[model samples]
Target: MKSDVLFTSHATAKNGREGHVKSDDGLIDLDLTMPNSDSDKKGSNPEQLFAAAYSACYDGALNLVASKEKKKIDSTTTADISFLKDSEDNGFKIAATLHIEISGVGQEEAEDLAQKAHQACPYSKATRGNIDVTLNPKAV
Candidate 1:
């Protein structure tokens, strides 16, 4: 197997438990705030980061799958990712919804291609059985 390119990032303290993340390639600039237990300000935490990453990765994977299947997928594909709270664990949960508007494909073929994409997508495979995912195709 060929070696893959490695990426590195560092997080610096912004102020009082908050920080900013910077990648070595200068590509990412993210401000991170810790969850405040006292104030109950737990929104936009790590779960949101996970959701964004998973959603983008899944979309790219879907595009690659479509290309390999000789299907045309353009800018019409939309993906929404939701991160919910796990009541039992008091943690976060993830759910993904995908809508594709590919032209010249029947519903059955589109569904099959989507299923294949879901299986082939790395993020989908990684989160399988852990998160709820919904795939909808607007092609007919």
Candidate 2:
């Protein structure tokens, strides 16, 4: 059987622009908001979701690739995933950068590992050929 994950979630709009979302088990519960000019607005948007998922997926991919390659990574000290919005035909498109730190390996090795991970990451696979994905030696 194929490995799979089952998740359920629901979101409701409190107002015209604000909403809340929670998963079935309540582990992922957060307020959702549309991006606006108001800096004081509270809550997260889809970009945050994309970044979060990408980071986790990339991290898992890194570990899996490293294990297969016989590389030992001591730890992941830091990770930064950024979302960039630019003009698209319909409205806007989101691009991302995933910067992860692998402690046990040197710069070159870390970069190589990240690249391998990107190739294997499910998130990466899903987004492939649709958007402009920059698989930097840095962004897994």
Q: How well is each residue in 67-133 modelled by candidate 1, as lDDT tens digits?
A: 8888785624556766578887999766878776666577777777778878987788987898788
Question: Lowest summed-lDDT stretch of 10 residues in model 1?
Answer: 8-17
TM-score of each: 0.65, 0.74
The local distance difference test score of each candidate is 0.67, 0.69
How far out, in Å, is residue 25 in model 1? 1.3
Measured over all alpha carbons after superposition, the RMSD of each candidate to the real structure, in angstroms, is 4.7, 3.9
**Which segments of model 1 are wrong by more than 4 Å?**
1-18, 33-52
| lDDT of model 1 at position 74 | 60
Off by over 4 Å in 2: 1-17, 75-90, 136-140
Query: What lDDT tens digits, residue by residue, belong to model 2 across residues 41-118?
Result: 688766776677787878898899989988777534233334445555546566666667777777788888877887
